[model samples]
Target: MRFSKSLIILALGVSLAACSDSDNNDVEVKPPVVVTPTSYEFTVTITNLTAAQPFSPVALIAHTEGMLWQIGNSASEALERMAEGGDNSQLLTVDFATHAQSAESPLPPGEQLTLTLTTEQLESLKISLATMLVNTNDAFTGLNAIDVSSLAVNESLSRHSHAYDAGTETNSEAHGTIPGPADSGEGFNESRDDINSVAMHPGVVSQDDGLRSSVLTSQHKFDNPVAQIIITRTQ
Candidate 1:
């Protein structure tokens, strides 16, 4: 059949448009665009450097910018609980912290714990860690609100930590005062009989050192550095 000139032109136009659309579809579509949110990750390694003192479960927090605990200031109820009973439940409730974690068990002398924490909060990164010496009245050790925004991937900050007396309780080392395996004594007495401030821990005076009725022993004594902390950014 003979077609009109207008009909022929219209058919040609339609064929060309279909061919153009097919060509466009055949052109490689850049693979579906994918958008991923930025994430920050850190690896924390803690090593117990004491002789016989067992460290409570490490309480770790990755926060925006705030001190969890301060030297010369009274400790929070959370810290006092962990420092006394080796409990970490309360300390993990760091509302200002973007992320926080604790090891399952106590860290013994000469042992280490490595934990990785991640957060989407990429700015003003800081880390705080704490643990109790289960052998003392209220002795604890670890870093507090350390600035880590300057750390590069795979870069690390290492420090040897000194013991800190939480000062929430007196260092009696008596029959019912210590809470470690060495004593199995009671923990977390509400009455505050201590200096009520944080300070450098004085080494323990065991029964061997003339603290009569003391539950600790010579081996439980530790020097300045009680633990080591190494922090690194992985991703």
Candidate 2:
């Protein structure tokens, strides 16, 4: 066709534009990119601050909801087990826990134990721990659902935990009622003979303090701020 040069160029430009549109239509649409949550790790160290009380293996848990024990509430069987007998198996396997860790051995007076936990969840993340004063009847000390979501990587927090009575057993300090070395007595009895509600432990009354039947001597008595806990976000 004998078209003018300007008209020919215009037609060529139009054709190229159409071709580019066709090519663009043939390009496949890509799926959206998925973002994966990051994993975080935390190190928890527990130190016994008591004079003679040794702590049972500690139960460390990371969860979004719920606590191991609450004041004025009845103790769960899991809490009772740990508080009475120093058994942490039940607490470590609670249904609400996303991740959990346990100390390998009992923490003696002036000793400390470190445990670690990792999880991908950071929203509403909470940390809780529970351990028995093995010489007392259902007395435990630990953190309860302490919020840690605000803690950034490498950040740390420290708290001093007080002793709590599981209220599952009486603080008789009797011959066979305590599981610690002071008595070498029984542990984790399926009995609820005490108040059956959690409350601050009224420091123990030992033989020297007029609780004559108490297998615990003056050395076994303990007061508040029984343990010191330090938490660090490692990753």
Q: Pick the candidate with the highest lDDT.
A: 2
Each model's lDDT: 0.88, 0.94
> Which parts of model 1 are misplaced by more than 4 Å?
1-35
Superposed model 2: Cα runs more than 4 Å off: 1-37
lDDT of 1: 0.88
Q: Please provide, for model 2 over 53-140, each residue's C-alpha lDDT reduced to its tens digit, 9 standing for 90 to 100.
A: 9999999999999989889999999999999999999999999999999988899999998999999998899999999999998999
Clashes of each: 0, 0
Looking at model 1, the pairs that clash are: none
Q: Residue-wise lDDT of candidate 1 within 40-133, one digit each (tens)?
A: 8999999999999999899899887777678889888888898888887887886777789999899999999998999887678889989999
Query: How do all models score by TM-score?
Result: 0.84, 0.87
